[model samples]
Target chain A: MALNTQPNLFEPGKRYFRAFSPGDDFYEALIETHRDLSDEQSEMVNARLILLLANHIGDIAVLREAMSIARAGVVAKD
Target chain B: MLSTYQYPKFEYVRPPEIAEGRDGHYPVVIVGAGPVGLCTAIDLARQGRQVLLLDNDDTVSIGSRGVCYAKRTLEVLDRLGCGEEMVQKGVSWNVGRTFFREDEVFNFNLCPEPDHHRPGMINLQQYYLEDYLVQRARKLPNLEMRFRNNVIAVTPGEKQASLRVETPDGAYTLTTDWLVVADGARSPIRTMLGLDIEGKVFMDRFLIADVVMKADFPTERWFWFDPPFHPNQSVLLHRQADNVFRIDFQLGWQADPEQEKKPENVIPRIQAMIGDDREFELEWVSVYTFQCRRMNRFNHGRVLFVGDSAHQVSPFGARGANSGIQDADNLVWKLALVMDGKAPATLLDTYGDERGFAADENIMNSTRSTDFITPKSRTSRTFRNAVLGLAEHHPFARALVNSGRLSVPSFLVDSRLNTADDAVFAGNMVPGAPMDDAPIESVGGEPWLLQVLGDRFQLLHYVADAADLDAASVAALQSLAEGPIPVEPIVVAARGRAPAGLRTLIDAKGRIRERYDLQPGTTYLARPDQHVAARWRALDPARVRAAVARATCNA
Candidate 1:
């Protein structure tokens, strides 16, 4: 099966890591989403982003799944 | 005549030493045979998972590290089924008094909480408490407590953890499904993981003197702030259950640490707390700096941090070890469920969220307590004395008395903060929640919940039928269990019909009040670790489904 075609896994990366990262196109979109969250909520999201990224880098198995989730999520959006 | 309470003999069948490849692997390997690590192993083993417990110490216990255990920690131990022995051997004292100078004294009674199951505090030497935990850990069939083995390093991954152990026999590598670091505050595993601990390192050091003294001290804790005998110093005198006493003196930054064991200096400091009028012998005297700090993140890959590794508060509240134990209690079941394919991944995140919040709260409390008693400047010292002075005459100081005396009440990790409401019970700890005393009969001795009004750890049997839950929500709860809960985060089942299907858990007295807090006619799904996963007004099928889903998915 294609990487993104796995079952039960949700689409990933609809959310950005921070307020603005260099060369990121979703800065405006994330800013709009930021309006929905309080300061604590935004910080919670940031913390979750760090953990998810750590999971991807820490373990190969997690990285494969994360890649799949990212591919499938972006594919679905496109 | 023999001392009836003798330590048991260990003569177990030894396994042949085999090479690493052929042996079937364990899911997690815990280093340190301390109470926190041992109990964490037991909690996992009870869930039918395999664990390898490693400790560098040849035998159990090192020193009397933490003695003042709060009610919340006792409740967690009770869930682990060791509370009976803990309570029997330990001392329970609930009143705390602050002595200003020599004359003015104010006391705060920590006993009168609204709950009936537990009072505020218990006292046992740290060694005795860890001894009971090590005994319980040894009994688990899936648990292997490897003594004299120290954790050299930990490498965390998505599905498993790699550990290096330095043993007298030799060095060995271990692999497991998860890594839980319970090694003390200077945790080697934590440092390797690069977890940042952020907080002010208080320059204020203290003298912790555990001595056997005969004096006129009350059966409570007494603190002296800026007293004449030791002018511009702080004194913490706790009367432990027996003749033993814990005396801590706030030392200035310039004080020499070597003075504690100098033989010339130890006795004079001991005489300061208990006056020279009495005879006493010093057991252990250590002068150290009490730094207040906590890690920015509690998890590094498959590794989960609990107890001191995750956070360390000042000894002011006796909260550091107790809160870390709560972290262990909260994380184990969720990890078990996910590892066992019972719950979702989001549940693991709640471990960090809930526990980090707890550590943050405890840090705030410990810092406040430290500031109030051990002021930094002349003006701050005057303010602290003023507040403590009013404790007797004013109602506000009385409230300050409860601040450090009580623990942070246990509540669900994701539960929204309760805004001010007249009829609401406000705390992370919910009311009439299912407790850890799962009756012996259910799930073959695994931890289960006894509903406030329901029978012991009984499953929902059939909510209109056995599989009434919708697909979307069922999947959510299954994936996000923060810890071990009876309802399976999906559907905690029972052996029998239950007739009414849902029943209440009755205490020894058979009355229905929440051990933490109480609310009538409420159905709460308690985490296997015994914090409420989610709660509702009625046992409405849809609401139950929604709550389970909310708990599981963060929806």
Candidate 2:
């Protein structure tokens, strides 16, 4: 199965806050993955998390797209 | 420290060669009377070949080193005539629990199935093991043990290898057709011969403390990663025989080794892990940094390296001594056949090939376990902790946790000596795999399958009826038994009378048939080391002979 590049995560709105925000739950979950880690440790955790998610989404084309999109705005310092 | 056990010093006797002012020659000369060397000497002497074993020291190992013995190693020891004694005097454990912080993440049972002869693993001090092997070696008149006779020089030649030895009384020279270097990890013989081991040496350090205490801790392997008692570090707790416990603490690379080994420093750490109220005395303390490495080739001309001299692995898994015992097991039969001229000298090369493969496997697993226990980089530790945290609740994450993948025998699936299968078979007892154990009934009461199937090539033929053992099958078995390398045939009958003049074992509960995945006419060819060489659906004399020839490197 390929990675779903579209907005895939969602949560039902509560009574006071009724609104639709796609992928917000995923962003929060990703932040929680790095909860108590230090700066270096957080980066390491993210790298491992990327590998874990990549293995789960085991399509070469989807991984290539994901890698390209993730590095789109990053500039080489050297 | 030496309260419960007293070290036995073997008497050093003057060599006859030195007294007669002449050189001594032997069929096999094994250096270093450690576990591997003694085991090899015993095996060779049992085959009626004269063996000389030399050691620099007259005593067993100084400390309680190498405390765990795996089941496969136990089986080899059984063949060497000391497995029962070792098991009787050792602590047997099959459960291992891994803890993350204060919670138990997961626990595993090493042997979930029953009806086996030995347990999954046993924890016996190295001194006892060596002592047992030394005692067994003394019983063989063909084998001579020369303690305090150190080999100062080794010269390997095409036909033979010569050694210059220095005994307590004087010096002498000895030569042998084959030289086995089982000295140790820091092998002086290997250094003298200009050989090098190639691999990585881990930068982490560990402090091993063997403590004597009469406590009620269950006989199980307990490992901790970042526990409250020892935060940010790892600890391993194992129960050995004689009310002793082995505790290994991972003190990072930068810690002072000398300071960590002090009683004042080690005692408090043990107190922290096992509570302050428990009274315990330190029996032995050591600081070690492990390396997972091996020589490029185990066989170099006439000189062969076994045990730590051939390969070394981290102590995270108990692979060091266990794998070395297997190295001796794999090499002895081939060496015996070569010495007797029944097989060519090239047959010994398969020992190097097979054992070299096993060494790499052990080194790989030991390195992985070390990496998991002592993560090198911050990122690696982060991922490790993440896995541990998730493992507390998630079953998938538990599979990722590696608290020392314990040692198991390697499956020589790619061994060149094995003949490929010609028929479909169930289970993992394929060609090149070690034969699994099951219960059976014989005239001598009940014995495990492995207890009866070693020290030579064996043919386990299954039969269900008298018609199954037709004249052709009997002729095939008889002919195979008279071949160059005889194959001892043992019939496993499901429900039938014992065949006349044939060794038959009754499958009491059919567990043997189920474990071996045997049909009515199934036949399995096992090597002298008990690894499967080939299997067939029916008895074919020519095929069995060819497979035996291939297994012995006669092909």
Highest TM-score: give the candidate number.
Answer: 2
Interface DockQ per candidate: 0.01, 0.04
Residues B81-183 of candidate 2 have per-residue lDDT tens digits of: 8999999999999999999889999788877888888899999999999999999998999999999999999989999999999997789999999999999
In terms of lDDT, model 2 sits at: 0.85
Query: What docking class should model 1 receive?
Result: incorrect
TM-score of each: 0.72, 0.89
lDDT of 1 by residue, B1-555 (tens): 111123333332222232443333567877766777877888888767788877666654444568788776777776677877888777677777666667555666665544334556777767778778877886888898776667787777777887777666556677787878888888888878777887878877777777776677766767677677678777777765456677778888888888655646867877765677798766667777777888887876688888887788888788877887887777886687667665676778777887787787678667766665665544444445545555555444444432243464444433431111223444333422324333313323322333221211221212222234445534444444333333443232222222222232222221222332334333455444554545543344445444545555434
In model 1, what is the error at residue B110, expressed in angstroms? 1.3
Give per-residue lDDT, candidate 2, residue B186. Answer: 96
Q: Taking the true A–B contacts (Cα pairs closer than 8 Å), what share appears in each candidate? A: 0.00, 0.03
- Candidate 1 overall Cα lDDT vs. reference? 0.60
What CAPRI grade goes to candidate 2?
incorrect
